[model samples]
Target: MSSPQFSFATTAEEVATAFSNEIKGKNVLITGTSLNGIGSETARVIAKHANLVVVTGYNEARLKATEDALKKENSSANIRRLVLDLSSLAAVRKAAAEVNSYSEPIHVLIHNAAAAIGPLNLTVDNLDSQLATAHIGPFLFTKLISPKLLAAGTSGYVPRVVWVSSGAHAFATGIDFDALRKPNKEGYQAMVAYAQAKSANVLMGIEISKRSKGRVNGYSLHPGVIYTNMNQKPESIAEMQAIGILDADGKPSTEKFEWKSIPQGAATTVAAAFDPSLNATPGAYLDDSTLANDKVGAHCLDAANAKKLWEVTEEIVGEEWVF
Candidate 1:
């Protein structure tokens, strides 16, 4: 399929406006919507079009703040808050159940939250912290809410699951199944673990697209290199420099990088979720608001690996989520 002719400079608000008629009255659920983050911006833009916008975060204070910000943007906006801590499997499941209890079909599910450059650690579930927070928790949450997404299809809406993957997936060797199953401090490399989780996110989208068979569309995207709270911390900045994402002076490298504004970073995600051109192309990898033909690595597009990831994720989550 030919890539869409979208300007790389487009912002989330523009994308949302372009599709406002189509997405009006739709219900959207977005994760990791803390203040001043891409997810928050995405949710804000989406609220302009969607009937109900649910923003979630681990911190109650931040979640409330985000809801308040959205309300401020549009006082009449129907916004809800879900307290979700992706680091815990139990919390993810409970949150998913709460979303389900709303009795409203979910038209779009955006897995926009992620943990980056954090210390090596294990969750109570014994899974790698990065993997659990970034992939596993979102994977399970998606599974539980899929029925709602599928039901929305009956109304002629093209329900979507948007996985916010990163270009960093290109740096990962592959999924270390053993390490994910039993992560030890000695075996953990923070960036590598994060890369693996990002790769898994892409694979999860591919697998979900296959299983849903058109009832629900899935897409993964690299929301360009943006300076957000997730990657702007001192530790995260040091790691970015080490990985050549930034320069010694703490600025993005001009030669190979162009940092995106928060809204700009969210353009591709908004495009993937509502672009009519993508209706026939589920499981595509998008970057810079267009289909990325070659930038997505072979590993991320591996079907067999995607299936394996689906299976392993089910096992880790201790639930059979048949689509």
Candidate 2:
């Protein structure tokens, strides 16, 4: 399981082409696949080789758009559009049920959806919106669809969960248990919440690797700094301009931060999903396109926090994951 020679500049199509054997005929489910996003690009390339590609989003119309886009990339693609709002448990259950009904093993499940860094808002389940959408909902969805992943493993296919985290996870040194339980207006900062949620995604990878007991592999990664809908907020654009990420005319620049194109941004995710080199490390955190050895923050390396988050999420979702 030697690491492949891939860099931040690699494109998703390149990785998919390189791993065409691995991606061929596999069933992949990806979340947050709206147009002009990394998830959509990842799905589009995989659809070129996959037998079934399920594109998911919170909006039905957007999911349809993603489905059409994938089909355009591969005319023979078998695409399924699923509406999944990660903020709601009910929605997660419904989506999981739809997936389970397919009777096909899910060879790869990519949690590419996330809530934006924003003001404090609680879901109907009384949890922080960011935490619920980014971690808790994906946690529950993974658990619910795990049987399909395990089924893939039983059939001699390597089933893995790819978590699309960020290097920004360095913002928080650890998970905020209190904030997850009770998100209030007091002392709430958007970046901190975003950090915790992103770190939790990495933690989920760690715990899934430990708990899955070799039946499933888990991976998390930073997809470089690709400007997508996730970071195109009005205030964020003004701030980016101040930091030289955007020029005076509000166009992207290479002055301060080096950015990636959507396909380049998706390279790590595409590699994590199909690259056999990553099989060596079950709970791997990658940056650029390979292991994030020095780049990943200390907070993301804590196995204890990963375990605790797994347990707490079970309580939040009111369903135990024993596999």
Q: TM-score winner among the candidates?
A: 1
What are the models' TM-scores?
0.95, 0.94
- Taking all chains together, the TM-score of candidate 2 against the true structure is 0.94
Candidate 2's C-alpha runs over 4 A off are 1-4, 234-253
Tell me the lDDT of candidate 2: 0.86
Show how many residue pairs clash in every candidate, following the order shown: 0, 0
Model 1 ranges off by over 4 Å: 1-4, 248-255
Q: List, residue by residue over 38-105, the lDDT tens digit for candidate 2.
A: 99999999988898988999988888888877777678888888889999999999999999899799
User: Cα deviation of 35 in candidate 2 (Å)?
Assistant: 0.3
Clashing pairs in 1: none
RMSD of each: 1.9, 2.0
lDDT of 2 at 15: 85
